[model samples]
Target: MRYLIYICFLISFTINSQESIDAALINSTDIKIDQIVALDNFETFYYLQDNILYKQNKDGTSINYSNYQLGEMSTANAFNSLKINLFYQDFNLVIILDNRLAEIFKIDFNTAQPYKNVSYVSTGFDNTLWVFNIDFQQLELYDYKTNKTRFSAIPVQSIVLSLESDYNYCWLLTENYLYQYNYFGSMISKIENTGFTQISKSNGHLILKKEDTLYFKHKKKEDILPINLPKLLINQFLLTNETLYIYDLEKLHKYQLKIN
Candidate 1:
C-alpha cells in the first residue's frame, strides 16, 4: 500500500511540473498606451497604415518606407521580422512587411492563370495571408515575401473567428473548433469547443476566452482553470512576455499570471 501511494505521488508531481505556466504578473497597473501605431517586440513599431515602417524604442523613433502595405501580422517568429498583407486593385497582391513593419514586397496574381479574380485576404497570422478567389470558393496560402503559394487547399465554408501562426504551427479558429496546422499547411491537431469565441497566444502559451470566462492551457494539458475577468466582452487579447493584455472595446486591461 505504501509503495503504491509513493508511486502515485511521483506521477502527480510529474504531471503538475509538466503542465504549468509561470505567471509573471497579475492585476498590474493599466497604462493607456496610445496610437499603438503598430507594436512588435520591445523595439519595432508601426502606426497607421502607411508606406513607412517605424523603428521604435523606449526613448527614440524613426520611419522608413516600404513599397507595399502591411496586411496581416505575425508576432511569433520574431526573428523573421516579416509582415503579411493583401491588396487587390489592378492585380492580386500579397505584401510582406519587414519585422520592423517597414519596407514591403508583393506577390502579383494578375499575371497568373490560376489567380484570375483572386483576392488576397488576411488571416490572423503575421507573414501569412489567405488567398481566396470568387467569394471564398477557393482558398490558398500566400507567403508574404515570396508572394507565392506556400500551399493551396480548400477551406470548409464557415464563419472564421481568428487565425494565428507560430514559427512551426498555424492555428485557424472557426465557431466550433480550432484547427492547428504546420508551416507546410498540414493538419496537426483539432480541438472541438462550441463555446470558443476568441483566442490569443503570448510567449508559448494559448489563452482562450469563452463567453465571459478566460481559460489558460499550457501545452497539451487536458485541464482548464477559470481565471477571473472583467465584465466587458474581450475584443482581443495579446500575450507578451509573461503579461496578458486584454483589449475590451477601446480600453486595454493587463493581467499578471503564474503558469506554474
Candidate 2:
C-alpha cells in the first residue's frame, strides 16, 4: 500500500485548554518496580524491575519471566493480556508470552527473511505488530504470522521519543511532532510536540508525560489539557481505562483520571 504524507505546520497546532485536571491519590502500593508496563485488569498489572518482568496480582500471587542474554528487556506490552509482547531492542528480538508468563513465540528481526532493524515494537491486531523499522525510518504494520509488512507509513524525520498504538490507530511521537496513522497507512494528523517524553493510549485518549508533568488529549478535541498530579517521584507510568498508574521505582501509585 502507498503511504499518504500529510504535513502539518505549527500554525495549525493549538492547545484546547491551559487548565489542569486533578489526580487524586487513590492509593499507593509499596512495591519494587523499575518501570510500569501495563494493567492486565483491575487487580493485576505487569512491571519490570532489575531487568526481570513481573505480573503482580492483588492477591499477592505474582508470576515473572526473565531473559538476561537478550541484553535488557527494553519494554513489555500487555495489550492483549493473553499475548504479552516483550521487546528486546538491542537484540532486535520480540517474544510473545502467554497469560501465565510462559514463552510462546519468538521473532528475531535480525535473522528474519527481510531483516528488520526494529528499534521499537507494540502489540497489534490479529497476530500483527506495530514495528518501527530503523532501517527505513518508517512505521509498519507487520504481520508476524505470514512474515510480511501489510502497510508502511511515511518516514519520521526526527528522533522518535515514544510509540503508542491501539487496535485501529498508531501514534508516533518524535522530537518535533506527534504523528497519528490509521490502519490503511494514511496520515491522520500531526501535532507539534511541546515536550512530551512518554505517552500512553487508552480509549482514544492520550496521557502524555513531559518530564514529571502529565497532560491529556482527546480523540475528537484539539485541547491538550494538563493533568495535575501529586508530588511524587515518577520514573515510569501507564494509563489504562481512565485510570492512571505511576511507578517511581519504590512505590506504585494509582489515581483515577477525572476529565471534564
Worst 10 residues of 2 by lDDT: 1-10
The TM-score values for the models, in the order shown, are 0.66, 0.89
Clashing pairs in 2: 16-223
Per-residue lDDT of candidate 2, residues 1-260 (tens digit): 12322223222332233366777778888886577787855678787889988998988799999998898888899888888999998889999999999999999998888999999898788888999999899999998889999998888899989998888888999999999888776888999999988888987899888877888887887778888877778787787778888888788888998876
Cα-based lDDT at residue 160, candidate 1: 65
lDDT of 2: 0.85
The list of candidate 2 runs beyond 4 A from truth reads 1-18
Each model's number of backbone clashes?
18, 1
List lDDT for all candidates, in order. 0.56, 0.85
Candidate 1 deviant stretches above 4 angstroms: 1-55, 60-92, 99-101, 109-113, 116-139, 143-148, 222-224, 230-233, 249-251
